[model samples]
Target: MEKKLNHLLADLVVEYHKLQSFHWYLKGYHFFDDHAKLEEYYDAIAEAVDTVAEDMLMLGFKPESTMKGFLSISSIEEAKNQEVTSVEAYEAVLADFKYLLDEVKGVKAAADESGDYLTSTKMDDYIEFFSKAIWMVGQEVR
Candidate 1:
C-alpha cells in the first residue's frame, strides 16, 4: 500500500514539472492568454502533487521528490525543449494530459490491488480532471 502510494506521488511530481515547463515556455501571439491559463492549470497540478505527497507521508511512505525518482516511476516524458511554439506547446500538453490519464488509471488499479480505497478514489478524480482537460486542449489544436 505504502509503495503504491509512493509510486503514485512520484508520478504526480513528474506531471507537475511538465505542467510548469509548459507554463514557462509557452509562446506565440496567444502568449498572454495561454500563459496565464497555463499558470493557473500548472498551479492546480502542483497543489495536487503536494497533496498526494503529503498523503503518502501520512500513510508512512516517504514521498519521493527527486527527478530521478519521478523518472523511475512516471511513464510520462519530461519536456525536452523550451522553444516550442504555442501550437507545439498546446499539442505537447494535450499529449501529456492523455499520458496522465493513463497513469492515473494505473494508479487507481494499483490502489485497488493494494486495498487502498482513498488513493483509488483520488486517482479516479484526477483521471476525470485530466480527461476533461485533454478534451479542452484538443479543441485548441489547429
Candidate 2:
C-alpha cells in the first residue's frame, strides 16, 4: 500500500513537470486559454505530490523525490522538447488522468484490504479530481 502511494506520488511529480512543459510549449488556436489551464493543472499536481508524499511519510515510507526515482516508478513518460499542439497536449493529459484514476482505484482497494480508511479517503479525493480532470481535458480535445 505504501509502495503504491509512493509510486503515485512520483507520478504526480512527473505529471506536474509534464503539465508545466505543456503550459509553456503548447501552441494553437487557444494558446492563452490552454496555457492558463495547464498552469492550473500543474499547480494542482504539485499539491497532490506534496499531499501524497506526506501521506507516505505518515505510513512510515520515504517518498521518491529524485527525477531518476520518479522516472523509474512513474507510468507516465515526460515529453520534453517535442512540439505539441494544444489538442495533443489536452489529449495527453486526459490520457494521464485516465491512467491515474485507474491506478487510484487499485490503491483504494489495497488501502481497504489493509484497513486504512484514511489512505482510502485520500485516494478517493484524488480519484474524484482525476475523473473531473479527465472529463474537462477530454472535452478540450474533443
Candidate 3:
C-alpha cells in the first residue's frame, strides 16, 4: 500500500473508534433514537475500515490497527468522556462526518496518485455515502 493510503486507513480506524464512543456515550431526551442511529453509522464505518485494511493487506502492506498508529495518523479528535447535550451530540456527529468526508476524499486522491483505480473508486463511494449521511445528521440537528 502507498504511504498515503496507510495514513488514511489509520485515520479511518481512529475515526471509527470515535464514532463508536459517541454512540456509547450519547445521551439526551432522544437518547434511544439517536443512539440507534449512531450505532448504525459506526457499524458502517467499522466495515469500511475493515475494507481499507484488507486493501492494504492485498497490496502487501501490513495493516495498522494499533491505538498508537491511529493516534499518530488521525486528524480526527480522540474520543473522550465528555458530557454533551442532544444538540451537542448531533453537532459533534455532523462535524465528525464532515471530517470523514475530507479524509475519504484524501484517500481517494492518494489511490489515484498511486494508480490504484480500484481503491480510488471504493473510497469515492464511501465519501459519497458519508457525505449524505452527514447531511442527514445536519437536518436532524436543524
Candidate that scores best on lDDT: 2
lDDT of each: 0.78, 0.87, 0.79
- Over 1-142, each residue of candidate 2 has an lDDT whose tens digit, in order, gives 7688878888888889999888888888899888888999899889888888888888888888889999998999897877679988988898889999999899999999999888899999988999998888877777
Q: What is the alpha-carbon RMSD of candidate 2 to the true structure?
A: 1.0
Better of 1 and 3 by lDDT: 3
Q: Quote the lDDT for 83 in model 3.
A: 59
Candidate 3, after superposition: displacement of residue 140 in Å? 1.9
lDDT, residue 76, candidate 2: 92
Error of 2 at 71 (Å): 0.8
True-vs-predicted CA distance for residue 93, candidate 3, Å: 1.8
16-40 per-residue lDDT for model 1 (tens digits): 7776787787778998988887777
Off by over 4 Å in 2: none
Model 1 segments more than 4 A misplaced:
1-3
**TM-scores of all candidate predictions against the true structure:** 0.85, 0.95, 0.89
Candidate 1, number of clashes: 0
TM-score of 1: 0.85
lDDT per residue for candidate 3 within 1-142, as digits (tens), equals: 4676677777677777777777777777888888888788878878888888888888787877788877887777777877566687778778878877887788788778889887898888888888899889888889
